[model samples]
Target: MSAYSASPSTPRTTSRTPTPPRTTVVNVEEFEMDGRSIETKSADHVPIVFKANPFKHTYPILRHTCFGVQGKQTCEVRDTTTNPMFRDMEEDDPQIQYVAKPFRSKSVQKPYRLRCGVMNYAWGKQSTDSAVAQWMQEGDPTYQVEQRPYAELWVGTHTNAPSYMQESTGSSSNLVSENSSFANQSLHEFLQRNPATLGDAHTEQFGTDLPYLLKILSVATALSIQAHPEKSHAERLHASDPDHYPDPNHKPEAVVALSNYKAMCSFRPLPEIAHHLQTIDELRALVHEDMVERFVTVVGSDGSSVEAKKEALKSIYMELLLCDSARVQQSIDAMTARLRNSTDLSWVESTFLDLTVQYPGDGGCFQVFFLNLIELKPGEGLFLAANEPHAYIHGDAVEIMARSDNVVRAGLTPKFKDHKVMGEMLSYDTQPLHIFRPNNEGPLTSYCPPPEYPDFKLLRVSLTEEWPGVSYELGKSSGCLLVTQGSATLLYCGKDCTIPTARLEVSVGSAYFLPSRLSVYFSRMTDFVAFIGECQIRAG
Candidate 1:
């Protein structure tokens, strides 16, 4: 017997008899169908028939009636029904009352494929050597790689370069066929129309715009030594010089190594920097003698507070940046000549030579001694706050940051350098580099940022052959997922269906925009790895 089966009922009479209407409350999910609100009342049966439409293929709308008896509510189809739209339904079900209305489809509220944008910077790797180029080729078969370098693959709704919708997935054949205009729409435009995808709490907190931008970077050479301004300073810079400072937003970034990666992070420990300044004659020549003496004295004194040490470091750094250009070049030349003649050189000396070769006579070359030079293995990560000076030296990595592009360059580039602003804005607190280690749980590893930076988090899913399938519940926040390795079959089963209503076959480099509160299952053919970038807003 069926679970919905009930005892036999008497037949209806032709003679009409009026009865007083009474209110009764029953528990059941409510939704609109054919422009009518479905509600339960004090009645034995209220038949319903879902109109056939494009969404019928995507959403599972059942044909049933509510039975309210003795304060109890149950749903069942008590008789057979015949309709051209529902010929596949069971013949024994009760007849349903059909309401005629024009068919209308709801806004998109599910995962869809995305086509991200790519940037070609000079520091990027050339041709297929770059992971960004390779991923671009994999995602778009029509894309052709040229001789120029490919640097970053941007996956967000930043105004400079926004991602577009490639395709939408579901069982809705009419939606896919008739509503083809949804494809190729910018993600920013889509979010404007459908704010629910970002969740109510997120939209309220972050204002409908995506809070973070995800990027895949392939570095072949050293990038410019730069720092991003804080929120207040960014606004001031943008208002004063809009060309150089493109946006009025701070950019706090975190990077996870996809391969062996080398980068210059925050300033080194006070003792280490003081030692280098005292020993390295070439480095000490650029800064003023008085400023260097004060910095060394402050750093060496045990009684000096952290704030005093930071002020002293800032004084020396500013002197170095504001020094005469000819003296900076002469210092670079002296360092190069000495390093070439010396047989034994430390990594710091070797890196200094490399920077001088890449960017000759640029004062940024001396930053190697002042900053912490760190190398990260695969899976290792680092977080850089706003106003902290850093540069990516080489290798591939996944970088996520606030949606902004306001960089104050110090050197190593032909672009406009804001040396004065860069010097004043830097947070010259010399501390050891703290590497972020992900919290691992089975096949999933979460790279959560510090509590102060609650804008975004990264989740990495690694599926091995032994554990080939996993279910991911997105809870109540939207996110973008990119497949970095292998391939998998994704299944999305709606709330009312026992089987999947949408199935997508994804391969390496594929990216999808996942809606809020959606659960998806993945079945892999082989070892697979994917990263999901999501906002950290709390659900309301």
Candidate 2:
């Protein structure tokens, strides 16, 4: 994992070649869609340098370069957030009178088939059952692996498991990474050069960075019982411990089920929790009597104000979570005996039995009562706001979130558990949470909108040949599209979205990075089911 938080700067102008510029073309993306061939074009225009001769123009594309003589080049890239220097420079030399345009405003990002890296955390599913493993196999036909835990397939500009562009010239393939390949840089570097991919709105809001992380998670065991801190808390944590809290950004995640999914998210009703504290001897014994009584009183009270009720809940919970462990376990053992006699089972009971078999007497086995238990079929989704605690119990999912990994784990894992931080960040008041699914819209058959997250947007598209022609503008911003099932034909169109440029073959596990400033239509998809991860970039 790499940690890079570079303060923005007015990067010095560099050249790909010597002064008398040499021109070269880079193949952005090329693939077969259905039976047709499609492709897009990008050319290196001109190089900028603080030089004398304004009249002599060696390089082409733009009529005039921004930098002429006089050493007055507008190269303040550091002021991207406030006042970006993205304008043309006027030529003062009497020898030539022409409009000199800066290359900064022109969209330079190109879409490509991306090569993503995988995270193999211990809580992953086996090779056959893992969605990430399946995709890896598809991404590389020669890739064959012995059995291993496959956790996450990450495709984004995140410092951890950052993705790379797949460049192909006939049989030879090139990959770009932190070690640097092709363009000699990482995805983050690419974004820095082409801020237009995020558009002017996102460029101003989030700078040149991609504000979201795209991931495919395949979990066999439960993830940690954790809550993501808001921006301020994240900043504080990162400032305190750079090792644990790597980034200083809030994380709000959206999970879409690729398989049968189960999770524990948010808090259940007050009455249901009080019942657990009453009926479960372990919980009652662990919590102080006065605290329990006050909780029960609040739950049963008719004339209690909202503030009083909230305080009652928090007060009781703090006591319970911070209870002495030796005595708490003794109470838990007694409660284990009581569970043998009980008939009805809550999430706490059912999950406790299953977890104890997996973890054996870990405290989180009983934490199920505090959070809502959710079950979702394929295509269902869930959105977790910052500070909302959640644990993925079982399932495969395509998850997207703000480009941050600021977790305060409390239980359900052997990893670091910071209850103090967790307590401060976690929100006690919550309603029963539900998964978000895409709604149907007309004509534009493939598009889905109003993504739950403010940073990034996503939708699962099951396109077929029968639907009326639908178009999406990937030409302006960057995005990731991973084909999950069947084969699809993507019609890569030209600048105006009028002519066919290239046909990319999208098969199961085939993932493509949508370039900035290139729009295309999945003109004819053959029962193609894919997840497209992209952020909304409002035009200036």
Best by TM-score: 1
Tens digit of lDDT per residue, candidate 2, span 1-540? 001111112233222342234332122221111111111111221112221122232322122232332111222121122223324323454332223233243323334666787898888998867888988887676777558899998888888888776654332122211122443346677667756555665676667878888889998999988999888889989999988899899898888888889899987788888988887777677778988898899888889877787788777766656766677567657767767677986656767767656665567666787788888777778888888878998889888888987888877788888877776666787565756754344222222234445577775665544342344555345678777777655544333322233455566766766655455444333565677777766544
Candidate 2 least-lDDT 10 residues: 1-10
Off by more than 4 A, model 1: 1-109, 168-179, 438-441, 493-500
TM-score for each model: 0.77, 0.73
List per-prediction Cα lDDT, in the order shown. 0.72, 0.63
**lDDT, residue 222, candidate 1:** 95
What is the per-residue lDDT of model 1 for residues 331-358, given as tens digits with 9 covering 90 to 100? 8888788889999999988998998888
Q: Report clashes for each candidate as comma-separated counts.
A: 3, 11
